[model samples]
Target: MSDASRSGVTPRRPPPMAPMGKARYRVMMTLVALGLALLAGRIVDLHVFDRSFLQGQGDARTLRTDTIPAHRGMITDRHGEPLAISTPVVTLWANPQDLPEDDIQRLMLANALGQELDALNERIARYAEREFMYLQRRMTPEAAQQVLDLRIPGVHAREEYKRYYPAGEVTAQLLGVTNIDDQGQEGLELAYQPYLAGVPGKRRVLKDRRGRLVRDLAMLQEAQPGGDLTLALDQRLQYMAYRELKAAVTENDADGGIVVMLDARSGEVLAMANQPSYNPNNRAGLDPQGLRNRAIVDVYEPGSVMKPLAMAAMLETGDLPLDTVVDTSPGWMVIDRFTIKDIRNYGKLTLAGILEKSSNIGMSKLALRLDDPVVPAKYRALGLGQSPGTGFPGESTGSIPAPVRWSSSQWAALSYGYGLSVSALQLASAYTAIANEGRRLPPSLLKLGQSPAGEQVIDPDVARRILGMMDQVVEPGTGARRALVPGYRVAGKTGTVRKTDAGGYQEKAYRGLFVGIAPVSNPRIVTVVMIDHPRGDSYYGGAVAAPVFSRVAGNALRLLDVPPDARDPES
Candidate 1:
């Protein structure tokens, strides 16, 4: 330093340094050691003890488990015609925190979504704390894609399903519709919901800071799609029945109507259509009444339609034979001040003649002679007073009262179809016994692999005789010529019952009903037609209801390729 200082210009004065003390040196060295130790301990704690918690916290923001919506099941007719199906759709969701805060960007998003700007703002504010919310649910894929093309942050489309009914209103009341969540709410859909709904799947996914999905990590569970359901309903027959029932209701200026056709051998419902039907696809303001499947739900006192059943009951007593005769004086009689009358004076009628003439007096005498429980018990065995067991929701077990005392008037009223209520399905099923030679098979809406074992409710000979008597009613009795098919022998009964109110029966309000089986020699199709409150020229079942039976039964028989038993006389 002295040499440099002498040679160079006062060379660099050694930077002045403070004197070093032992205590100060030790203090500085101790501080440096403490600082390194604290850092090393922190690193160990963070990488070892707190590692999992830290990782989980970080993943809570950057990773998410998403649900993959499963597709709902399909509903088809017996012939594989689609009744209801699920179509692919998209749902839009958002993370409120990740959404654009700029008013202009938000306004663009609102416009793209067809929502008001103010509404969008309110919704975002409401969900400010939530990371997820649905923007729009169940939108068409193309429609949802249009908005996603805006490239808005936090906006995402999720795959989902929308239900579509191919048969539209034609199958509406039967197949029913799903809710926005794709859950069944009514009809057969509601009955089989457990089998129709699928399990949703979960998957872990990576998300960017803006909460937009980047990539799928791993599937936590696989989506399980719902199973398909096949019904026994025949679409062609259903359409025909719907068309005819609609026309009959319109022509008669009736309130509403129901037409139910059953396969007599298998007890499978072939066609069931109700009036005042609604389009399930568009149920924005549907009346709940329009959704009623009258064939299985609504009940009515089926006037003379009960006569055949009563006759069956009487014959089951073994006290009355088909050829036995009874005197019907003046065509009328009195019981409990209730006047039960026939159409006119058919002074004396054989048991078969009573049904042929639809004689109330003759039927009253027969019922009064039997024990009260006999008729009610026989009706129960014939599937009346019970649900048809079609597994249909809201199925009515029609009321057949067990009166404390069976009065003469009660017996008289019961004889001609009063004092008890029966649904169209019940009546149709009851006649299945006569149609199937005295065996009443359990009614089914599912296509059966084989016919179920039947409960024999009546003797084969009596059912045959009753079938023959009903054939006479259609051909030369009260069913009127209008019920006749040109190329088939029809067996049926007519019923005209005055609709009752809280007070009493309404004279002007009547329900016309016809229950029939076609090709009586070898019965195949059994049909029931009901018209409520028909106006104009006639309100009788023979006039309003029988003709509908003719059209529906005639078409159904031909559609089934049931060989016509009644040869065409001209041919």
Candidate 2:
């Protein structure tokens, strides 16, 4: 061929090497080569595989993780009566960054989210750069549903529990309330949080397209409900006592009032009532003053009600005898720089006469003799300056200055209840030692498997001697004339102390206090009453607080079927 012709035809180069070309052979060889390739592919897929694409697509098919909320436990009283309960509350949450694309739904949601708009806006503005933020928490179920119906993307509802009070302010001082997050904040709820609150459980669940729970992945551990409480309280007695306490505060136009009832034999508190009280369910509306459980929270000079405790301490230490006598002037006496005065004085006062008259001068002198080195030891033995451990949190350790802290006026003032401060309940408990035949019982609000046999701090004989003097105050003296219970021998004392005002004492605003035991034969209850800042003309305990105690005790005794120590012949 000519060179030109060969170049033009271009060498056709042996079919440029078809890789394995129809296979050097037969149809069986070709099929066998295909089979081998298919097997190789299968082996690679089964062992040394890359499943990234498949896993990514599978994840999109369903959820990657599951989560579930734990159920809160219930709280009940000693008798199985529900005092505090946990109810489901729904809260709205959002991922504003992923706000729904639907304009109409957004508008509807914005409107349903009224009232909390400002707060919601603030929250959104803060996390404007973030992925998610809670819009509203502690929402009512109805409100949560309305928000959910908007069907906004990244917007959802979560369930939590809120505390509820069935008895409301009636049991507020003892039961206390929990915060919106179901955490204990005060009272028995706070003190016993560990046992009363349950451990949270975890659950994993798969959600559907609509965010509904479709599958439960796992339940890590079964949550245990909170154990129930058996209180020392009787509901009937609590209501009656609160009613009386409220009425006294209202009638006397006093700033506040407190009523505490203790079972005489057992030191268990049967009822604790404080007026100007707040509803735990509506804590948002409560005023700061209304939140105080005055019986155990506020400290005051217990006034003349402390006279008996002072005198008992005196006799217990042999500082004074029941028959001891002193010269008491008309109604006053002069001490060093501070002149001491009495409500009224007797010409010649016996030791018992000092108690009957509530003579400040007499108590002051008696206290002078009681200034033994053992005074501090005696006070400690009485449990002063220590918490009552009554299962009520934040109960103040009523102030009792150390011996080194007491100045010259302090010794005398301590006897008249000026230098020392004590909660109304503490004074009530001290009187309990006197009425209880000298055993200093520890006060308790919890239901005990057994009550400790209290230590005998005072001889029963000395205690009864003190009790007799106190009983006299009730019979022919200021207390009995006011705290009159028809059949019951109400042994108690009246107290009137000028309250400490701003920088100094308010001579006008007095704390009227009374503490007593009823049904002398088998003392069933110790009633303590205190009225703060009474504006009425009669502001003394004999006028304002004791009457309330009589009314409350009368009803409580009858309701508890303690057999009215005596029925009001007038009633």
Candidate 3:
């Protein structure tokens, strides 16, 4: 101001303003141009180079790829009866993060899912970080729809299939049961899982904020439905066997029972039933013991039922004939501190008489005469000590001790159906060799288009003679009298095996068994019955198991319309 006042008339006035300096103006324009260039590069990079990445991030929020479930195959009996079927079901799931926090909505969702509100809240809290969680699996379609109608956020339903068994408990152990994911858990279902479980397909879809599928994005893959399975079981015969086995178990006050019926000509398992069986349709209260297929899996000392097999093996050596007599006087013999006895001494007994009396002494004598490895070899040839090759899960290869190291006492025990074990299926299949006239066919649970090739295990003539000897078991005063059918020529053996406990054989604990072939003239079927721990005075095979065989086989034969082979005296 002093300089201006001195230069001009006013001291506050300053020199006149001049144009902006070139350098300063250039600096300002350069900064503005740099900012614009940076902005333009950023716009190009976002719209071009990183475009797909950003799109993926955005799609991840609302788009989902789902699984398209394939239906499982149907399991049918020989007559086309549905043993197992698959029905459409739905699974409810949710995302905890997307679920509403409102208490009322949460309560409604919990009720729909059959869960308590507190439990649901706790589950949600526990899975708070998870994007998906199962609410209910395998719910009925209507129930799942009820859940979806509520339209709670983050809740969803997925289509699936559930297995249903039409035969219920009758075929429970045979057909087995599946899991909530339609995977086989046991029985034939597990054995054939590869064929029964189809490959699941995939799909891509868009979902809304509430987790509902809004549109089909793309078809990722096509689901392949499983193939069907036809078993050799006859539904009618299965029902009958179940009924008879259950009745016998109840009547004898026994712990459990099993019955297996096979087509003698084909080795087809026409009927197999076990008591303490569960309902495949409802597995809520299933006991592990009840899930066992006893006929195919349970092993036991077969008692006198093995006598015939021993006789057949000895006869094969040409050293013993059907009618060869053995002196059984005094009824009992002792070997190596083990006493082998008969009910009574019949001075001398032919092979047939030994079987008829269920004579342990006579059979033991016969077994002792055989050389080592003879008995076990014959048993192996008859499908004992090996799996039946039916592809059944947990199929047992019954124990048969090698004869190489066996003592005379052990051999004798083997003769009278001890010192070894045999499943009901193995015993029945062994008898089928006799019924099939020496041709032993491997057992099959699946229906066969033709009779399978069989191994010739015994002489046809020897088998016929054994059949005749077995027929004598059903005659009056024989051990298996109760196994007689009024109008059929029945051939069978009776067994009363002492159960082995921790120390040794328990006298009162016995397994009664009967293995028979009906219409012995031609031998159409082989039926085997085993009753476990019969608790009454009459625990013999003839009294407990033979009656079941009589009822089941007799009725089964008639139902199949096989003409009676025995002449009716009244007619």
Candidate 4:
């Protein structure tokens, strides 16, 4: 007490204990309890009831949901040779927000990305809000590795797949091509996209601050790989056809060309090729014209090739026999204002001889003698003016004028294949019916385990007679004599049609076409070759297209091990 008095007067006496009251103690205790209860409630709510919010906040910075890519299906030939494949590739990307701010660091990154520094900076600025941007897509693994070696921050590489065509330009027109995202763009690839495309999967994963994957959380969906497509194509036959067709086009200085080979018995497309093709892998300067599958998409007047179908129509009437004679004296006949003529006058000839010589006037007279609907009906039944149902994109169904509206000249023009148009594929399919004994089987682009039932378009007897008549077309002095293969009896028809322009038909331009079947005795394969606007010494089908057919058919037969049905010419 004496020391307190000396320090301060107010400290002399300690204030009497002012809070000995129970009510104040109870009130303080109650306030402390309420504060503790609120704290515990908030903690429980955060840990249990509202835990998702906290979890989401954490995941926003450290977790990502990523796409698991699925590879497109492999396209293989009938014998399992790869035609189209998916190769593993790398896609280099960057996070603009996390990219180095230093200009020197950015310059290094640009050099690694093969981009100008200014351009890289501009791109980053444009996509600053976006955390991810593609720096390079579809890069080789080596290139991606080189990019990763730079050790640039915010740069990343992801696994992807690129579509590659092993056959290159050889199968380009038939197999079509895929886009950067592996979606089909043209040809059979587009037509069968559903079957060839895969279902992508999804997964969640934890990532570090630097955006590297730290742990896989869960798989949201399983990826379904696309089903492999086994096409009816025979790679050996395809190569042979492509080589021969390309050679023929170059030799003739032609505009373009197409070659189609079919299994006569099974109606499966063995090989289909087009000239002016492009490499599907590199499409830097691809031409739209070259992208067309000319065999199925381009149509032209079949010229004299329709004569055999006309003859078959006449034979079906039971009034005209294979030996029935028609007089063609003047080499030309007037139909309205137009004149139908042959290259030379053959005074009188049987129906078979008419086809052998490709006599336009003779065919015109035979068509006039028949009822109006006969020829058109026969053509329709043979799948003319209709799609072959091969599932090829952009396939053309050629035009066929109605028979009821035909004038005398129109009917005559129809007889020699002038007014109506037909694709090379349609011509080959029609010839296939003849080879298959009047049974018109549907053409297929996929491998067939068994031969499909064919519709009977003509009587088997009539079909056989027509086939025999066509056989003579490959004999000496016949139009398509060059279509013959050694040790094989080839039957076929030749067509030379004038190319049409904006005004009308062009006199100098012609489409030379030959449709044939090999080993006439067995008729195993049907092949059609078409050369567009041949500018060489000859533009006739026999001279330009027949040789291509011969080479392709001969090689295909040998490769297939088809037995020779006739004595070898040398033997």
Candidate 5:
């Protein structure tokens, strides 16, 4: 039409001659064709090459919460024997915000359970206002399923675990118990909580109206179960020790008794037992008194049994010799009006003789020998009064007062094992240095990465000599007559002390103590026995605690398959 219009309509513009509506239709068709091609490709992927992942995503919505309840690892003994294990049980938990009270209206009473419905209701109800709470723990699987069937609003059955102790009270003090939370609470359980409790994982997915996962989760973390725990306790030995202590406590009418057995060479605690123990399953019945696990927790005047440690300290320091004699007669010695007395007197006794006779005055003399700042330095070296550095939770370190401020009376009293308090575990562990040829390896409840290539606490020769002296203490000396274990040469000492009270030292209260090593050629165990407040007659260590020692030692040696020693019962 016009020259300018013609140039504007050059070949590049295509002149817009075709129907505009038709061109729009062509573009629409092209877009529709591309979309169809994409759809076909997706369909091919869904039905063929990668159908599982996509189909799984769709299935996740209905079955999203599929879970696997992994078994908690078992706690085994050093021998790979089961000490504690997880037994599956159903725990009842509820979303308190949605639960109806009618679901748990009453707790059914089962004689074995020991709890009433009313009590159950109260315990759970206390936490009911909270969003989440445990309604019950460790219920039977069948009972759990029944509760689940009720399908009460917010009421759900959670599968959990209950700790089962195969040896029951025999290993209770060491294995410990867990709370309702399926968590470890005390003893070894507390010690290994982190490693023994596993990492819990989670997954999230869309669910259908029926609560089944219909689509695969965008988030799925596979749960890793807990690692198994191995303990240092020997179940059989523990049971034997427990039985021995229980029998002795009942027979002696003692207020309480403690028995500790140590692996003489390794310093590993083989067994530790106390009387008046409660079944862990019924922990609610445990009294503060009953709950007092005395082996590690209790500290008392160790009496004459402490002489060996004191004597070992002096000998190891090369400051005192076994033949060094001290005058210990008159059955008493007065230092500044505070008299230190022997339960029985020996006129003149060597350091070894003092321990053999269990002479308090004799041990007092030895403590006096070491009373020089340089002497009891060996006492400090032996780890007395310090915590055993043992890994056991709640263990008491015991007390050894600094002799730096030693009053004559305190120093004298400390000599014969009064004023200075020691735990059975500490004493046992310290003796390990002697039995281990003078090395004090840190005691442990778990296996060590490296054995306590330990610190030197004594001269090897001195330790050997001490062992021999201990043997004689059980052979023909004061600690002898009662601590006779057939077939083994046992070496140890006896101690009898007036139990102190809040008012003052109890005039009549006594603690009978005995500590010994067996198979003297190569000591196997360091066993210590302590009996408190023995009633009626025969309260001496030789009379009360020694018999306990004899029974425990005899059984322990035999159980260990220790070869018989050269000892004549008649002799």
Candidate 6:
């Protein structure tokens, strides 16, 4: 400052400062250029050469491939009524490592999830070593949404399906149930699993830091919807049968019951129901017995119901005629030291009279005339002693002693319906031969477009003659009179079978059964009702099972619009 004040021109003169030294300037410029080059190289490497690695690292945190759930198939009755369906549900899951460390956030999450705080803490601790854990499964979307809205770290929502049964216990045993993962576990559901469970899908999506889906990027696979299944069940008829059968079982105070109604022409199962059924939709504390489809799985002695087929066999041998008569003065006979008795004696009875009175002695005489194998052969020919071919799981092939060897007592018992076991379904199917003019159609659970060509198991004339004789069993007002319908001709047989134990037959336990065809002039439906261990005053098939048949048959015929055909319209 003093120098400038002293000399006025001093500022201009003091110096044109020398330019920066060349080497130092060059070194500084070079250093700056080198730094910029390194930066440029790094940018190029990140955008091109190392692009995948950098992008992959970023994507590891934000992008994810997720599973898209598939909806299971719908099961409908023959008339397009819903029976079983799949409803949308949500499942909550978590990544333990990504969970919030704060206790407050965890508490909020536990409350929203409807879990006890202690339990949630225990669960989280148990799975701390695991990256993935299921928090809750198969929750309603509304319920799961509440938990998801908390935005708790590591929590996620997955779309899933839960099976819903529309018919509830009405169709439980038949439709069966799926597992927690929606895989079929029993019944027709198990039979048709591959056809019902559709293929799942995959998709790529972007998520935020908190694991919330930001946007869908691309579909890796398209989900395939399951195929729809239409069964041969008539829901209306099924309800009717179920109601009538349940009422009978309750009124009789029976242990259990089964009713199988079949279309005689098409062989489609119209309605099959069992007592003590469980709701498939909710199966907590379910008794395993409630899951049995008793119609197709349980076998018992056919009792007196086997008489028609036996008589048919006798006629087929040309050894007896419909007008043939037998003497029953004593009311009982001894075959191999075993007594075969009738309810009472009618002295001499014609073949038609024998059936009308359900004469055990008369059938015994006819059986004595035939070869030992004749009656058993007739049963086997009529679809007994075999699976009914209904595509059901655990279908039983009922047992019959091989005709190769036997006893006179056994043969005589067989003629009157004993010494052999048949399922309710097999019995119903056997009656189809008598109802369908000796043609035995394979039983079906699925609907068919037309009636199948059937196997002829007996002479059409023999079947017709047998049907003619059974007409008297109902019309006489002596046997099975309770089975009479208001405006239809009914004909069938009743059976009261003594249950067998490890030792022998039980005197107190009896199964009452009835198999019948209605409007005997045309014979459209074959219905079988079986009540196991009826404890009421009467356990006779004519008393217990026939009334159930009358109710179910009357209602079913009207529902199908089959016109009434009784000679006296109001009886």
> Which of the numbered candidates is closest to the native, going by highest TM-score?
3
Candidate 2 local Cα displacement, residue 541, angstroms: 1.0
What is the C-alpha lDDT profile of model 4 across 228-251, one tens digit per residue?
A: 999999999999999999999999
* Candidate 1 residue spans exceeding 4 A from truth: 1-36, 125-129, 567-571
Candidate 3 residue lDDT tens string, 497-545: 8898889988788889999999989888999999999997789999999
**lDDT at 73 for candidate 5?**
67
Provide C-alpha RMSD values for all models, in order: 4.7, 5.7, 3.2, 3.9, 10.9, 6.6
RMSD of 4: 3.9
Cα-based TM-score, every candidate: 0.91, 0.84, 0.93, 0.91, 0.79, 0.89
lDDT, residue 74, model 5: 82
The true-versus-predicted C-alpha distance at residue 163 of model 6, in Å, is 0.8
User: What tens-digit string does per-residue lDDT give for candidate 5 at 1-571?
Assistant: 9887878865455556668889999999999999999999999988899989888877654555545445566888778888878888987666655655563434432122346767656766777767677666789998777666655566656667787878877777777777866688887777777777786655766665444334666646676777898766677788888998888788888898898888776767778888777677767657657666688878887877766766766676667755688888888988778777766667988766777776778766666655364334555677777887766678887777775667767766665677777788888887877777888766666654445677797888888887888877776535467897877788787888888879878887898888888877778888889888888587888888888888888888888898888566588
Per-residue lDDT of model 1, residues 1-571, tens digit only: 6876778765456665566766789899999999999999988998898899889988998999999888788888999888989999899999998899999989988998899999999999999999998899999888899899999888988888889998777878888778988899999889988888889899999988887788999999999998899998999999999999999999999999999888898889999999989999888889887898888889989899889888887887787765688999898888899898888899988877787778889989888887645777778898888878888899999999886777889877888899999999899899999998899977888888988779999888889989988888887435456789878999888888899989998869999988899889898888999999999689989999989989888888888898878855688
lDDT of each: 0.88, 0.76, 0.89, 0.89, 0.74, 0.89
- Which scores greater on TM-score, model 2 or model 5? 2
Output the lDDT of residue 112, model 2.
86
Query: Please, what are the lDDT tens digits per residue for candidate 6 over residues 1-571?
Result: 6877877754555656457776788899999999999999999999999999899999999999998888899999999999999999999999888999898998998888889989998998999998789999999999999998888889998899999998899999999999999999999889999889989899999998767799999999998978888998999999999999999999999989999999989889999999979988788889888899999988999798888888988998887866788998799888888988888887899988888788889998888887547788888988888878888999999988886668888888988888889998898888889888899888899989999998999899999999888887886466688888888998888888899999999879999988898879898899999999999999999999999999999999999999888886365
Q: What TM-score does structure 2 among the candidates reach? A: 0.84
Q: Which candidate model has the greater TM-score, 4 or 5?
A: 4
